[model samples]
Target: MSSTKVIYALYNDDDVLMDAVKQTRKAHHHIEEVFTPFPVHGLDKAMGLAPTRLAICAFIYGCIGISVATWMMWNIMINDWPQDIGGKPSFSYLQNMPAFVPVMFEMTVFFAAHLMVITFYMRSRLWPFKKAENPDVRTTDDHFLMEVSVSGDEEAMIAFFKNTGAVEVKVIEKH
Candidate 1:
């Protein structure tokens, strides 16, 4: 089987990883991926990744949720089976809007949260029982790992990573 050579640079600190990322970008080296024990702030910006549109999607989902909640509540309370509770039989949605606020808020939050998770999973191509793609298991503990594809001289790339504060650098063939 054909395999591609890649350099795996390990860092003990997030700061070092960030600096390495910047240096790699400055050197015009493409970073295949970065694995960190936890979320590193501004890493995406440093990597020059575009802003995510998840917020926009969440807003749209919230709108749909509120609309559904409103229609359901109106149909049940005003149109289909008008309630005559507390001697308020106006059957007007606007007049009874305050009473539906709780349901609307709940539905909005539920839809936004659930749909956003689904969107993130689908966008990331994650699924149940999928094999892990992590190159190094240390990345899941206290270390950060950067995967850089080798384009030219492997030794030069290794030296570059070492100069960029990598605690350990190794070249591996990925199938």
Candidate 2:
């Protein structure tokens, strides 16, 4: 694969970075990515990013959890070894559903949370022992980095970033 020239603009404050994002969008610049130490509220809207669909995945995972819990409980209590526990006969799953509410709720929450984390990690291409893809290490601590792809006019882009409160701006050849 070939490398491309990209400009990295480092900002000290998230407020300044947010403003710069707005100005960059206004000036019709295509921002490749932005890295921040913490989540910056409203930055997604400013960057025109689409809303995440992770909630849909969570809902599906929850449904799967509930179904599995119901099936497992039915097999254990009603089919495999039906027995009288706490003076209640394990005759019908529907009749004994109230007793299984806590289990069902816990399973639903457990599946949703665990599966969501796994899904997020997979989607973001994060894995154990993998090297960080961030261009600047400072962005993980106190700095914010904005990457803008440049086809021409590197000097103008650097000047634009400096004008927008960038602490440092440099053109990098991204592999």
**Who wins the lDDT comparison?**
2
For model 2, the superposed segments whose C-alpha errors exceed 4 Å read none
lDDT of 2 at 149: 89
Residue 121, model 2, lDDT: 95
After aligning candidate 1 to the native by TM-score, how far in Å is the CA of 166 from where it should be?
A: 0.9
Which lDDT value does model 1 have at 158?
Answer: 93
**Over the stretch 46-130, how does candidate 1's per-residue lDDT look in tens digits?**
9989999999999999999999899999999999988788887646999998888999999999999999999999999999898
Measure candidate 2: CA RMSD.
Answer: 0.9
Q: Model 2: per-residue lDDT, tens digit, 17-117?
A: 99999999998889999999999999999999999999999999999999989898999999999999998868999889999999999999999999999
| Model 1, TM vs. native | 0.96
